[model samples]
Target: MFTNDTPRQGLLGRFVAGLARTRQGLAGQIGRLFGANVPSAEDLEALEEALIAADFGPALAQQLMTPLHQRLSRRDLSNLDQVEAALKRGILDILSGVAPPPSTMDHQTRPQVLLFLGINGSGKTTTIGKLASRLITEGGRVVLAGADTFRAAAIEQLGLWGQRVGADVICHQAGADPSAVVFDAVQAACSRGASHLLIDTAGRLHTKRNLMEELKKIQRVVSRQMPDAPHERIMVLDATSGLNALVQARHFHEAVGLTGLILTKLDGTAKGGVVVAIADQLKLPITFVGLGEGVDDLQPFVPETFTDALFARS
Candidate 1:
C-alpha cells in the first residue's frame, strides 16, 4: 500500500512525474483555447475541450463543467487563477468518490489467489510478476500458476517471473488443461502453506468463444478446490487503448465479475483521463496504475494526486 507519507518519489515519484506530464498536456490545451481577455463561455468551452482531449470522454467532460460553468459565468472573469480553481474542482468532483482498494487485501491468508484476466497485450503476466514481487517484499510467500496454456511463451514468461521473484510456479506443457494447472497450483500452495497465489490465465480476445469458456472453467475449478479461493479477480487494462479500454472492461465484467481494475502502460499515454471515464461508467475502483516498465512501477491509485496531475497547474 502507498501511503501519503512515502515522500512521493521513486515509484511514487515517477507516478507523480507522469501525472505532471498529463496535467501539462491538459493545461496546454486549455490555455490554447483562450487568450488575454476570455469570456465566460469561452473558458467553459476551453475547459471542455481540455478535458475531452485528455480522454475524459465528451459526456463526462461536459458534465464535469456544469458547475464550473455556473461559477465562471458569475465569478470575476478577471482572474485566470479562478478559472483554474474551478476547473480543478470540477475534475475532482467526478473522481472524488473513487473507492480505495479493499482493506482485506492485506493477504493475511495463505495461498490468497488472485486471478489475473485480460486480453493479450494488456500486460497481465508482467503485472502479476510485479505484484508477486511486491507481496514478497511485504513478507508474503507467493506461488504463481501458469494457466495460460494456449501460448507456450506465456508459461515460459511466468516461469521467468517466478524465478526472478523466487516464487513457486505451476505450469504444464502448452495445450494442457488450464483448469488442471490451477487445481494443481492451489493444492501445491495449500501443501506448502504459501501466503499468496497469483494465477496467470491465457490472454484471449474478448471475442474468442472457446477461450472465454476455458477461463470460466478455470475459475470453477479453483472454487471447487477452495470454496473461498481467488479472493481477488483483477482485470488489467491498457491505458493507451482509450475508450476501447471501456469496452474491454464491460466485456470482462460480463464474462466474470471484476473486483477492480489494474490499469497498465499509463506512462506511455497522456490519456490517463480515461481513468475518470472508466470510474464514471463502470464504478469499478481502480486499485493500481502502472506508470512504467520497472518491476516497482505499480502504485495504488491516489485520487487527489491524480486530479492535481490532470488538471492542476504543472
Candidate 2:
C-alpha cells in the first residue's frame, strides 16, 4: 500500500519493504480482508495469525489487536478505511509505550567505562567500535580495550576499527587474561586523560559458566581501577534473531545488570517489532541501533523516529 513514488516515502520505503516481506507470509490470507468494507471472522482470525507468525509473539499480537477487535465488534462498523485506520492505530498505540533512548554521560570520573557484553555473533565488538567512533566525533577522547583475548581475530578487528576511527586500542596476545586487558585499557584511558573507555569483552555463550565468570572478573577489576567505572553495561542484541533474542537478553541482564540495549541489524530485519516487544517486556532504554554497515550507521535510538519508520506512509 505504500508505493506511490511520493517524496515523503524516504526511509519509509525501505522500512516498509523490509517489514512487508515478513508480512508476505501472511499476505495471502489477510490481503483480501484488508481495506475491505466488512471483514469476516476468517479475516480477523487471519490478521491475528499474521501478526503472531511475524514473530510479534502471541501476547503482543493479541494486545496489538485488542483495540481493533473491540472497535470492529460494533454493528455500525464500517469500511476498509475504518479497518485500516484501526489496524494502524492499534499498532501505533502499542509502540507509543516504547521508552526513550539512553542519555549521554556527564563524565564524572577520569575515564568513564562502558562495557559491551553479548553472546558470540551478537555484534558486540563492532558496537564498541561504533560507539567509540561516535564519542570521538562528539569531541570526547576514547580508548578501546580489546579484552576478548580468547579470540585473536576479535582483537585484530577491534584494533582495525580503532585505527579507522583514530582512537587508541589496548590489547594483549590471545590466551591472555581478559581482565588484565581491561585493567590496561582503563589505565591507558586514565593516563591519557581520555574521556571515555569502551571495553569489548569476549563474546561468550550464556550457557558457558567459565565465560560468564571471566566477565564478572573483568568487571570487578575494572571497578577497582576506577571506582564507579563501567558506568553503563550495554548488551548488544541481534534484532533478526526473533524470540531467541529475548531469551538471550534475559540471560545477559541476569549475568550482568544490563544498563541498556544496543539492537543491531534493525535495517535488515523484519522482526523490528521485536524492539517494541523488548521495550515493553524489559523497559530498558534502547541506547543504539545499527541501521547499516558503516562507521556512522549506529544512531542513538529515538522512539518516534523508529515508530515513524515502522508504520510511516511509504
Let me know the TM-score candidate 2 reaches against the reference structure.
0.86
lDDT of each: 0.79, 0.74
Candidate 2 C-alpha lDDT tens digits along 1-314: 00122234444444444455444544644677755767655667787787677667889878877766776676534665565567666655554555442345554676788898888888888888877877787688989999888778989999999999989999999889888899889889989999888888887635568877888898899889777878888889988897788888888788888888888877666667677778767767676777767776676665555655554442
Q: Largest lDDT belongs to which candidate? A: 1
Candidate 1, residue 197: the lDDT equals 88
lDDT of 1: 0.79
Clashes of 1: 1
Please list the residue runs of candidate 1 whose C-alpha ends up more than 4 Å from where it truly belongs after superposition. Answer: 1-6, 9-12, 32-39, 76-78, 101-104, 205-207, 312-314
Candidate 1 residue pairs in clash (backbone atoms < 3 Å): 9-13
